[model samples]
Target: MASTTVADGIVDRLIDWDVARVFGYAGDGVDPILAALRRKEDRIELVTARHEEMAAFMATGNAKYGGGPGVCLATQGPGAIHLLQGLYDAKLDRRPVVALVGQVVSTALGSGYQQEVDLHTLFKDVCAQYLQVAASPQQLPHVLDNAFRTALATSSPVCVIVPHDVQQAQAPEPGQQEHGIVVSSTAYARPRTIPDVDDLESAADLLCAGRRVAILVGQGAAGAEGPLREIAERLGAGITTSLLGKPLLDESLPYHCGVMGHLGTTASADLMAGCDTLLIVGSNDPWTEYYPAPGQAKAVQVDVAARNIGTKFPVDVALVGDAVSTLNALVPLLPAQAGWRPEVERSVTAWREVAGQRVAQRPSRLNPQLVVHELSEHLPADAQVAVDVGSVTYWYARFLRLPPGVPAHLSSTLASMGSAMPYGIAAKLLHPDRPVVALAGDGAMQMNGLSELITVADRWRGWADPRFVVLVLNNGDLAEVSWEQREMEGDPRFPTSQAVPSFPYAAYADLLGLRGLRVEDPARVGPVWAEALAADRPVVVEAVVDPDVPLLPPRQPEQKVRQTLRALEREAEGGQAHELLRAQRAHEEAR
Candidate 1:
């Protein structure tokens, strides 16, 4: 009999790849793999969640921060089923994540055992690639090899279904495929082409002639911060970011204007509208709603994805190149002139003061606006912040400027709840040298996965440093959605019994051997948040926000959402016009 088992081979491949931890929960379907993973715990740590769903989220968070594929394992049926939501987040966000689901014995797979579903069918569409590993001796490394390759190459989710019988079976003879990983990083499928210097100079000349110029940063400017700031400084242009580009420039920076899009600030939009030229850096937004209003400014768009060029508005210039490369190429062509940047900055300052004055006038108790303002001032520059989906998502998405490249892991599109705790665990694994904190909601935290605190404890050795602190905006109900629903259709009596429900958020913290604090007074929040950040272990703060306070807006959602729906509906009701609605086209909203 061969000394090595099939389980041994599977784990060895993972261990060789420098995967520091694996996130999952134990069930009968994946028991053998769990046992095998444990044997290599010194090299590959095994992290278990209360639910397999959390495992997937944590794994993607790890991949997002670590810049590689993350591994998640789950059992049959509901275990595999629950993992889909987080997996879809990874797929959409373009993070590489792999899910290993354990099926029943190969013979029992289609026979419908207790927790059996055709996982291949259930997961195929959601994943970039799905593979069903065979239960024979010769099918060794080929299965494992394909899983790793597909994940990295596409930067999308992949699946490898391991049957229970196959996992526990004896190992096969040594083969070439077993040690056959190329161990290479995948290149971007679409690299930004270098633009012509003459074209860049022509665009630069147009921008220089304009009296007011503003630069718009989008997610496409992932690594172009330095060049962007340089361009802004050289041209005396105002700088603002898209929702995804919030951290590219610090909010406290003098040149920082407000954000762009439907959630954009009035002041930011107004300032940009006054500009004679708007230089879009690495954005592909087709809708004018995301940019300035129609005829607000003449536009020039740059992108690495060539297809996105001039797809939105009538682009006066389309610079087909990487954002950083283009900016470096364009900087020398411009003549130095102290132009409208100072005026733009002054306007932004005036607007902030006006908004602050308005906020200062409203002395509402349990004001979340107060909490956000104070917290933004206090958080350390390097501390990582993660948020949950709900009221805080709107607040932080609109306001919190932690700095670009910090990985503020949160869900978009799906906007599922309870990703905070799980993503915190993954961030800790990825960023062991830094602290990671989660800002979540009370009602949103009800979806389970509290046990992941223990995983942080395991990594931090139960010390009380602010490695992971979860701040709960506990307003007593699912008030964020409730308020949005009420404002949308007058559905006043939806459900409120569980709205103010209290679970011992602190009690669970103690159970997990982590420190917990509850902030009842708004005055105590500034100090409480500070104390939480200073701790060495995981911490939880259950903050009581006023349920009556505007989560979205008391009466503003209908007009805003209706406008969005109508714009989207119009695009959907037509064809190439659909691109504007599709977010794939550039100019429907502009037109």
Candidate 2:
């Protein structure tokens, strides 16, 4: 029998923790660990990504969608450096991810060896929860155990840097519990948490006192849907979700005001503005201006993390506990009523009409809104969505109506581009039987998504379900930033900065041995989506959408509108875009 090495020990700990896969790109620095993984291939799979950054993203996505601490590995120096973007994504989004990075040999600690880096210092900020360097073979088990535990307990990224020499060293024997040895077991269980009874009562009292209440939820309120609905029904409250929270509740509910923020709907704006009392459930959405003006609404916040309470909005009562536990306890205290329901329903109804009008616009080119809106009709009940950050995010936020329980995730707080491809891949890997749709803008596709497409092609044949669809909004402009410049700075769309070089995304997909469908005409939008969703293999539907379709924020004030119009007037195609903006704003005002 082969004696267990420290690398083998690391893999053993991963198996003990039930980590099914580890995503990474190989390098000489991690050769020992890679060999160990290859030997244990039957127990735990290694997912090779095109880039280390993408691997980290896959890990982060796994954590977000799979509810486990995602594990990623990388070699020393550049490979470790490449993992930062995805690590930061995990950090900002507060997802549990354990990153195993290789370091230089233990003896070369001070010597500037080839591919050597100060891995601890580099990972310190992103993995602030825990960072450990294993110099001795005896320390491997404890360090790996602590990395997993800290990641799971804190719901944030952690790092374990193993020197090359340490990985090749002999592992501690089963009975080796000597004086200098620290043996640690691999196990962690989430504690059932609840706020104090008095705090729950205080929150209940605040909700009861309000005539019109609005419940704003974020990702933290994920499992509390049942109790959340019950409390909303009792308080006669309207429900609105932050972009991250959009998938937590059923949008089909009459009083559900889609999403709240710049990318949100008019009904959500009204829900935030009209409410006298607010119940913020596990939401730390940063759009403070969109929230009810500081003193307008009395608020109660429930969050698992105490640090998040009163950080975004002023709170009358803070219930630091699991959302489900807190909301369940507060439900009985709320008075049953239906007075605020009708008004909320009316707002939802009006917003639907506005959304319909916006998507129905028959522009000369394909309207981007129509590109995503058409998917709502054919979206599968079991599908998972991965959305990139850009104008595509706006369309997804406003138009796509996700079926109840269909999870859609994006780089929300970090607002990172090129996240959709890796995120979608991770989601699909977790549930091979379920289909996945990734939405991306031209700029985002070019950033890192195009390269990750090769990964999709490489793995699709192995998946139980082959219906992985990538929707690329192929407008030759960085539309989101262009609009932001006009809206925020009153600057005209700068062609040099905004223009994205044209690329035939559909053609590239076809070359990669996947089904490719191109849609430039407004007429083919629905049919193409239908074809892609039903394809036998992975498909890329490249929609040549109009770049000028304004990313107009909900309830835009007169001054901002004027600024946007002034910026538009200086552009070549301003007339058409100006008309589209006017029409969209008219829909909101008329609502």
Which regions of candidate 1 fall more than 4 Å away from where they truly are?
1-3, 129-140, 170-212, 262-264, 271-288, 294-322, 333-339, 358-364, 398-406, 449-451, 454-466, 486-500, 551-591
The Cα local distance difference test for each model comes to 0.69, 0.92
Model 1: per-residue Cα lDDT over 355-458, one tens digit each:
35323423224655556666776676667777788777766755565754566767754577887888877776666667777878886677654566666655
Model 2 scores a TM of: 0.98
lDDT of model 2, residue 428:
95
Worst 10 residues of 1 by lDDT: 582-591
- Clash count for each candidate, listed in order shown: 17, 0
Residue 32, model 1, lDDT: 86
**What's the residue-level lDDT of 496 in candidate 2?**
96
